[model samples]
Target: MNLNLPFSDNLPTNKLSASFANTSATYKFYWLIAIIEIVEKGQVNIKKREIFSRMISNSWYTVNYFHVSFGKQDLIQNAVEDILKFESLTKDIKKENLLSILENSKKIETKKLLEHFNLNVPHWFLSPWFPKLKDENNSNYKKRIYSYSQNFENCCLYGLYDENIIVNPIWIPYLKSNSKILKDFCYWNLSLFLQSRNPNVPDIPNKLIKPAIRNGLTKQTNEYWKNVFKELGYVECIFTGTKLLFEEKNFAIDHFIPHAFVSHDLIWNLIPIERSKNFSKSDNLPIFEKHFEKFYDLQKVAFEINKHHNSKSRYMDEYLSIFPNIDSFEKEKFSNTIQPLITIASNNGFLYMNE
Candidate 1:
């Protein structure tokens, strides 16, 4: 890492400022947050190879993914399609040409926008910046980004691969400077960037997305669930073996299938429990066999209570979605309802425990 590059006196020009300047919004956003996460972990130098892999990896903590449904697909492919769709929909990008190529991008092999990120999009969209660029020669993209960061004046990241990265001392402090007002500022932009479809324009500004920093996949809050759980006959903490009070904040909703595996919030996967047990289970899958019979009985009771009440029918709706084939709630076996969901959860990487 080159530690001694002289800092520039001027703030970044409009062309090189905060949003990375006409760069692919989808690509830039992921690159930005990945860098933010890496820096936050106290590592300044980065290997270029790590960037792509990190983009696709899942975190155990629930990501308040913007465009939650689209966000859940094969992560990398989704990002690539987002990049292509962004360019086509951007008014300033080779708008006509990109739209024309977008049709080609949907064909058999290219249907998923099906080529390596570096080799396909630029040339396909007639990208003025990267036409003819291939992954082997992809250093141009990184170098250009480094130049933009240098001009942006925050001086957060600088350096080429191999010799090592020279992270600016000001990097973290500058981005984190006013964090209280703009928490996870970069991460929100990444979500906006990823979620953006037909950009109202090709170059959406970073300022526009900053306000969404406080948003995410907020699930049912304890207060609402507390009321619902009482009706579900779950008036106690299953883990702590203590009675629950509606006014207390100690209650939590547990995902019978670990979220790392299922990444779902349907009422079917959730149950009320003590907060402490949730912490202990963390992202691990539970041994449902131990508690299945009791839970099945309780859920049926809860379903019947809510079935005739349309407003509360969500409880029934979610129950039915999980056990669609079973006509009689009383006759439904624990294995019948759970087996299918567990199969899906396992394929997505959930593990099972015999106990």
Candidate 2:
């Protein structure tokens, strides 16, 4: 049957799975990616109910405690709860709450109504597709999806996946079928489950799952930078004269301009700064004259090392966003390129940090 997955032929070629696959691996992750992979391979009109059935059954997992020093820790919980909340609403009803709550609400209380609005829920079906696409039939089908693990018996006592038990499948699909892709679906749903489900939670698409689930970037990036830092050598904290090693744990990938205003993690903006300074820098843009030269030199070293290691570090794309017209990092004058960015931030209420 056609899965109605968008980009039915164009899933992410390099990695079948989403980023953060290692720590957040789970059923939702796998199923979403799997749907995308299947669609990319040419499937359409996949039943929404069947998709949820697949999720509910295979959703079984352990208490997923992620070492979340970065990113949203509650992403999965919010996604899942929102899915269930919307699922509980009826088509005939006016969606009284536009935002609804799940019956199993105690597990993850969405403290605020905005929590409901902010949910990045996934679309399991296409309300409508191209004329050539097969028609969706919600007719009753056997709920065949189920899940279990070799070590559930040993770990179920404390894992969150076991608590993420979803029941009865029914809900609205977000976005139009024609407007979305399997990757979008995968990331939306999987990010929620992965972020929320600690251990034992299931996850990815078939083509992506086979390898994506097995490989990850957190460790890889850390390892890559570890080597780069070793090769490029070390530096002392600019704010504090304390000697800081360039090792992963010892430092953080800091956004000198503060991500709040710059809103990008281009390699030029990124630097290995002491963790203490990173926290202290918070959302303030640094005085460019004080740090640009150092960050510029460090970015070059980091970029060269990343290119040698992975050639296509994801950060490069963001880097290009800042320099949309330029391909190579060579031509742009550092101050000329960065000053425009600082001005943009200044206009947006971003304050400068002298330190």
Candidate 3:
């Protein structure tokens, strides 16, 4: 049936999928994109969530029908918490002003207080009113429509980030039906590979391998990188249907973009593909289409493999392209580390990073 979402009027009909497939696929689309933003960009900025919530509210049926697997949710929650912990370990923000802000919370004038502290927020977020588009029926409201379009576009272009790896291929149909092609493309990003769940550990699946790579959790071990992958999921390698039984599972947790090219080893640029394929793929650009095409139909493959549209690499390219002459290595380093941490830290507002 019709998903009576807020943006339904703006979008076309026939995109609705009343089935459970559509709901789950939509959630996966949202969750995956959000996770990628967090891992790569440092955080999914809270202000952007207001806009996301609006879009989601507009499409309630598509959202409610699909239930995210409990295992996926738990893993995501843990990852976010760990990153927040890392932020706390590195920086300190005093609670006095934060407490004062909470105590003096008034509904109307909080905007001024936020600005006084130099807090970055989108204008439309948390506000009661949303902008309306003008039809031929109303000439006076045209400017309002233009303003909303510009604001919404800006929010979408620069707002979201994250790197999530837990997805079931079963989501293919529902996403295909919605014709949210970009979302479908991202749902099974080839560059974002997953490990077979680990077998030795009961809760942890042996076959599963993490798609992203950063430094290990601690300074203690030599093989910390490998161990972290094992913990995350790296049970076996599936390369072009080669299920070869090796003496020891000779797999390497490689980056989607070779770390040699992109110094930052965040979640977006990682995957647990075969060591041989990783070697063959090397530092070259990610092969966006070939992997999943063999299994799914051509139409579904086309819908799911639009490289630049839904891919995080495209976002990174756009971000870097705007400031082409990034000469200062130190500035780059500081920007990389600080911006993401700050954005993530600000998420959930009062939930201290340490917690």
Candidate 4:
């Protein structure tokens, strides 16, 4: 997973390679990503707050929606959590909109959270280039790093300032030319760091950024439930209690445990609910204690029908992973499997309806 930066005679390739060496927090990785993004936009004079704001927005979904723990030491997750109290934004809010909101927010609390990084990340990220600054115990170590970066004859990544960092004219070409590779390097290292903290969490890399487009469930899954409705004559929405008819197509398939938490579309987790109710329930966990009996009954009926009539159904295999004996699916066994996932999703900050 090492990132081999393109060879450059003028730039310090060795320092770039060591940018994330022995990192305790995720600031450096995100700081570099923000820099690359601004550079790609053809901007050289970048605001420190802009970089910090991008850091929070970039990690927003990973922390909020996907519930990836960035460890107790990581404050980026904390900032994302704190902002929720002040704004009514969705976990899956678009990146550009999120960034604009962060950049334009007038709330002092928001500004304080972002500016806190200016104390260390701006200069500390350059420690790889100025290795001597590492051991300095002076109260003004950050000032010293800034001084060295500005006075260095060759090239430092950028010149630090009170409000912004000016990208070195020499490095601009290198940054823009290899922007994609440099970003890949940051994300590759970031994924490894997150994976260590979240050893049990699946799909670490994919969870890092908000998806451009979430893949919709395959038509086969939809048709499987449609067949269930056909055999039973009707299916009731678990959340709204509205009865749905198959011929009307007035139902939408929903994730029993919000797909944001599970990050999958397994058949066992999919259910058909009233189309209107599904819109309001977007990405929220259903109240399991209240909703489980009805959900389990519906799923059990689907399983039995599909197993007996359509023995070769593609989705029937999905239950075998959760219910080992598909022939004998018990409510208690299904409860044991789903209850903890709902609990974990709640603990990770996914909300329940009417919370």
Best by TM-score: 4
lDDT of 4 by residue, 110-192 (tens): 99999888877888778788776678775577888888777653378898889989988889999999999988888998999
Per-residue lDDT of 289 in model 3: 38
lDDT by residue (tens digit), candidate 2, 1-355? 2233333243321222223234343444544543443344343444333333333222211111111111234443334434445456321222223222332233343233223321221211111111122243322110101122112221111111211322111111211243246555554554454435322112312211112122223543465556676765775555565556755367666766655443333456656667787787776777776767666766667667676766566655555644563345663565677777666556544567746
lDDT value for model 3:
0.31
Q: How much does candidate 2 score in TM-score?
A: 0.36
Candidates' RMSD to native: 15.6, 16.1, 21.6, 2.7
Least accurate 10 contiguous residues by lDDT in model 4: 217-226
Ranking by TM-score: 4, 1, 2, 3
Candidate 3, after superposition: displacement of residue 91 in Å? 39
Question: Candidates' lDDT values, in order?
Answer: 0.44, 0.42, 0.31, 0.84
Question: Where does the lowest 10-residue lDDT sum fall in candidate 2?
Answer: 141-150
Q: Which is superior by TM-score, 1 or 2?
A: 1
Q: What residue runs in model 3 are displaced by over 4 Å at the alpha carbon? A: 1-238, 242-247, 292-355
Tell me the number of clashing residue pairs for each predicted model: 1, 30, 30, 0
Expressed as tens digits, the lDDT of each residue in 118-184 for candidate 1 is 3422222222223233353545655554444444233324443332344556555643443332324
State which candidate, 3 or 4, has the greater TM-score: 4
User: Is 1 or 3 the stronger prediction by TM-score?
Assistant: 1
- Model 2: residues >4 Å from true position, as ranges? 1-224, 238-241, 246-248, 312-318, 322-328
